[model samples]
Target: MSKRKEKTSHGFLNNMNFMFREQWNFEKTAFLFALVFILFDLTVSFIVIWLPKVVLDSINQSISPAAFITTIGTITIGLMFLKYWSHYSEQGVLKSAVNILNMHFYIKKDWKILDMDYSLSSSAQGKIKIERGHNATSRNIYVNMASFYPNSAYLLKAIIGFISFSAIILVLNPIIILILIISYLASAYVSFLVQRMEHSFKDVRAEIDSKLYYLLEEINHHAFAKDIRAYNMKSWINDTTHLFMDEKYRLENHIQTKHFMQGLFDVFLFMIRNGGGYVFLIWQMLTSDMTIGDFIFYFGAITGFSEWLKQIVMRFKNLTNANFSVDDYRYLMDTKDASKRTKGATLPAYDQPAELVLENVCFSYEESDRVFINQLNLKVYAGEKLAIVGANGAGKTTLIKLICGLLHPVSGRILLNGTDSKEFNRDDYYSLIAAVFQNVSLLPMSIAENITFCKESEFDTERLLDVIQKAELSENINELKDGYHTNLLPSITGNGVNLSGGEIQKLMLARALYKDAPLLILDEPTAALDPIAEDLMYRRYDKLTKNKTSLFISHRLSSTRFCDRIIFLEDGQICETGSHDELMALGGKYKEVFDIQSHYYKENSGVKLR
Candidate 1:
């Protein structure tokens, strides 16, 4: 137990020091001012206690001297101005520190989330970790930072005043100080218990708040507003919110009731403490040669001592709570990015077909026993258009992710041009591939900026126009009010135009063409379009791919006929591989699913099967 306590103490100090350096380096002067002003604030309380003693003694002695009067006046004005300046500077310093730390931590967290390994962000457990990591930032960590500056200083002042006042109480009567110390300690322990209990439930509260925020978002958000109203889910939404809050408040009331009981006991201890001290001090005055000023000084000192002790105790409690946040923040930062572990000495090439090879590669989502890809050994030669056609959940997209280095294999190596894909710098490897996912999304930005995903100054206008023409988005672009500069949605600019489903898909295709990476991945790129529109896009696939190595994933097998080769997947394995004619003659799973799709299309088209 002692070893564990010592380790926790060491960790607290270490994490506090790291936070000071990580955030406060730039605002050292503000932090220093905050510390100094806090000491001044503490000093004024002692001065207040001293002034009354001196003034009362002088009047009792019948000293009517101007010097004494003038001295009192001077001290009064001096202390007033001192307090005012101290307060002004403290606010100034604190504002600077708060603003800087918020920005500094924001930048750090934003980058950390952006740079975190996709494996961590892609899983349910990993997302919870990310939220916890985010909690370690912003306001919870803000309190920890405050503890380092103002709170620590407040604690220091409290300690100094507590000790000084205790000495004065001892001078009056040693037994009195001892009794008060015991009482103060007992009260402090009760307070600590109350605070610790509250702190212990903070994680539970945080989880509730996180879920509530998401639920509220889903209710109020544009994405669900139409559907929710159409479904008439208002009552269900209200019920869910009410149940969540009811549980939260029930837990809160339970803690509050416990604190109330503790408060009663604390009050009893304080009444005994205060009553005992008054009796002791009054008895001393009656029997001993203690002056009137001594009586006043000692009484004020005793009261001040108790106040300082409580402040000190509260400061300790604050530090203990803040340390938990620091621990989480530190843990998150210490977790290394998975891709950073294997950055070999190479940058993947640009403007060349990326030759990808998978040797017994496999992968699965975390917390799942079922494999998504199993022993997936395959080779994709440069400049080959390999169409991956499979049933739903056939690992088509997962295979593309592994080949493009968006995901790493679990058991075997994936190499590109004979060099291990994981060995290359992640940024450079990702730069080699351009992918359009099944879910097409556009940022609330200018049409040109969406295509470029870069600043207008950096964009190549000629190449962008060429890609837009190739993507068949030029006709739609011409219809917009601001032309290339028009915003895609009203989420940003009020005059933004919303595109039709097919137009949005075309815009995404334009983006992929604009990237023109060596490797292209199209996962159900034409899912939003009609059959005729899909065939039109399919006819242009060869032109769009040109010399680049491309992996096209689609459920519509008719599109695979244009590819150089095709692979059919089932139950986490590649079941067949061949061209359309070869698969048809072989009479495999590929041919059977293909014929089913073809027969349906032929019936709809009123055309004979070729």
Candidate 2:
């Protein structure tokens, strides 16, 4: 096998062993069921083969009627029990196993996402790989892990059946048995090759599908609805979809055509194997002194043995495909995010107010020339309220991400209470932050549930209601029939409570306050609201934060005056810093931008901003 193929096979077997280790005791229980079913079914099958011969022989010998009836009844009872129980056990085992494996994969994936290096999730290539790992579940031809156990069991059972039946056929004619086995095996080999060829394009297909998924999301997005209609994007959407669909269609069509031809060859091989058996059997019967019952039994056994061979081959093909999927899944589980360290590190520094300091922090994208942060040195004392203001490309948002531990500086260290941010346990470090972003995403859930983001067992209803009131959302929520329990969705079929932009921002604020993290970061949370409301929110920010160390980012410089300290970011560096009044007195970049924004609002009834 090629290196890649070898890895796929190795991964497949490795994961099977992993499954055993994960739930070894339970797997043995399932395998026990399989063993009983296979053994019983095998015995019943041979009895079936011998039944017709036994009946004919008894009739010719004039056997006792009572004995014959007893024999037939016994065989019939065995067959009935084996047939029903075999199906029941196999399906029951399959369903139970699949559910367990699905849950395991989910837990594993969630853990990886929660603890992975921030860089992996934040970068484009990393995102693609993460998606591929996600697609590894339920994306295989046989639904990834779904086919593995059943296919392996089928192969094992077929092998046992083949050995038992082939012994009978060999005595009749070994040459015929050998030729038929070879032909069937060859056909299966070809089929396996074709299947591997089909799976090769899966990654490319996943990439195209990801892009298409994004476009579909864009079209259906609630915020994009008005712009889509007004901008006449419907046709563009259809045309774009067709462009991608055409490529997918062409690729799939080509693969299906090749598979179709291979399938026909397999059919042709089956015909020759069966027909040749018929021709050989007739000649043997006429030439040899084989008894009528023996002749009939041998011929039937030969055909049945060939069927076992075909089944084993089919199982092999399924096994090969299933193994490739296991490879995909394992690859994802092992993929690392290199931004965090101390894999099992714990945080003993939590619960105290966090002092954040940046020591010559610099950040930039690998592909971009723009340095988002350049040798930036700053201190956010515990219980401080700081605002960061900048132009569109001045990297206010990037700075927030870096400080929040969602993005690490390319160079320099960030000190979290004297310890480097990367050295601290990432999850533990994350527990200190509560961020409300400009584009806050709400789940399709109840209002209170969205606020708390907690399960029922951990819910604090009184605390939730208080946060809602503080965020100025209590009145709006109370207006609804369901109040705090109102569901947010596109799928309530018009029954859902559709929150406005300001309401959404308020909801985001409610969540942040509910979290009560020491370091609260608001990335322009009020940028979408009217000027008066924005000003009101800025005034209330201190109260909401409880004077905890907070970093707020906004392009609207007027709304930032209330913060204790304001930093003006220009060209990826802090060009000016001090209180709003102090910066204005300096007559630097901060003063220039603030005046420009202040003049525009003054000329427009203080309702609009520049």
Candidate 3:
């Protein structure tokens, strides 16, 4: 757990300025409406406070009934207009503008996550920042950017009202104003303590919330449904959920207790201010020459003054809380993009195959100190078919990611066509290679869109058919009711069809082929296929890699026999390099693993060793 940095007033202002500038027109319109509403509200409050005094004065002076009625009626109409204007501006325009502004921030946060450095964005710390940023903009309604405009407007109104009411009370006696200020200051202190307590619980609440969310997702996810039912895990899950729920309840109760204590203290302070002030006023009215109208006016001023003072403290506290949320949002937005997506050297054309070289490349994940790919050096010639054969933890996937520019090396360079790959823009460099990893991910869209990885309008019909045939997915796709136009993932659409594991892998292969890049990488491409289907796919490998540089990774040693060269990885280094016959002749680690696999196959099917 990292300690959060203390945010300075200057940092808060900077973040606020950034947020306002991002949606200047919308924010400006909201602020204008807020200002109009606040002004009208204050006007109405003051008129209501003053009206009683005027009515009493009219009665004592014995004014004409018609004149009194006309005056009161005019004032009443003015108050109604002000109140209506205030309500209309606040509910109709300001609220809608704020809602739109909230949506803008949500979109901006998601876009930042999409555009940031892939290495960082996929890491543990990156996920924490993403969650915190999301919560800042959406979770807490009172302390989010959307509430900033109205809260600030109310703060301004409080300050103005405090000044106006204070002056009116001061005319009666400065001592009463001083006492009211002292009582409110004490109340403000309690509020500060409450705010601090709430802030302290934030991280804890976030952790519990994350756990609860994971559990709920597990309960609802289709993948977990079978296991949960087969394993009779319902009672266990219910108990776990209740444990966390009880913890959350205790936390809420503790927080509410603190709030209740604060409320009690406020009531005490309210009594001292109002009760003491009223006694002083009554004494002055009885002993001094204060009129009935004066008594009514001064009493209203004292109560209004105290209310305004309380608002001043409350609004300031709310603003302080909102500032913390802005800090979280700003922290994520300011993270440096290590991939340099915006500005970098242009990549060379991919008209022919690309040559790749790794020089003393070293890599490790942030959470681990042990190097996963240590000081590795290797090269793949242009237009060569190379095979990477290794065990499960041999760093094959890590090396492929480094070569594809998904992960950068710690202390070396990957040269693309003799130019350092880092010199090219990350997005531009991606255009040179088409890769299919062990995991096959399919989006909820038409099969054609998934293969093309583009919108329907941008798909190349002729090229799509070519790749589908080459990848051997034409038959499977044609069996579907809508053919290539059929949607995937029934969870997203009623007509969507879920493809089998092998069919999904074939679809992924078609997607990679449609890219038509200079370099192609297949990582266990036939993992889900039957043995015969896998052999058939491997036979087509030559046709697939015919004019491009290709790298094939697999644990099945026999499947890689046709490659021009094979490399065996052990302990994060290239332990052996040779063709299939050459490695077999060596009778080293490669031959040993191959013979074991051959023996198993011979026992199972009585097949001759290759």
For each candidate, give its TM-score against the true structure.
0.88, 0.88, 0.90
- Which rank order by lDDT, best down to worst? 3, 2, 1
Q: Give one digit per residue, the lDDT tens place, for model 3 in 1-610.
A: 3465632223657766865666465555666677788899889879978999999999999999999999999999999999999898777444644565557777788999987877888776777677767777884456675566566777888888889988898789999989999998888888878877876776677667777888999999897999999999999999999999999999989999999999999899999989999999999999999989889988888888888988988887777677666776777777877775666676666768889899999999997887889989999999999999888888998899899888899989999889888888888888888988877778889999999988888999999999999989999988988999999998897789998877777787788888988999988878767655666676676677687899999777887788999999987889999999999999998999988888755533435556
- Give the Å error, residue 580, model 3: 3.0
lDDT head-to-head 1 vs 3, winner: 3
Tens-place lDDT digits, model 2, residues 1-610: 6745533555556777865565554456767767776887787778778988888888878889999999888878878888888888777567656765676665677678666776676566556656666666663325565567777777888999999998888787888887788888789889888988877876777777788888889888777999988999889989999998888888889899988998899899888888888788888889988677877787779778888998898888887777666677666667665555556345534345678899999999865777889999999988788999988888888889899888888899988777788886677778889998887887777888888988756789889988998989988998999898788974762567788887887888889888888888999988888777777777777777765788988788878777889999977788889998899899998888877887768622456544
What overall lDDT, based on C-alpha atoms, would model 3 receive against the true structure?
Answer: 0.82
Q: Write out the backbone clash pairs for model 1.
A: none
| Reference-based lDDT, each prediction | 0.77, 0.79, 0.82
Judged by TM-score relative to the true structure, which candidate is superior, 1 or 3?
3
User: On residues 586-605, what C-alpha lDDT tens digit does candidate 1 reach at each position?
Assistant: 99999899778877677334
Q: Over 4 Å off in model 1, which ranges?
A: 1-10, 65-69, 140-148, 184-210, 239-265, 341-343, 595-600, 603-610
Error of 2 at 150 (Å): 1.1
- Looking at candidate 2, what is the lDDT of residue 369? 78
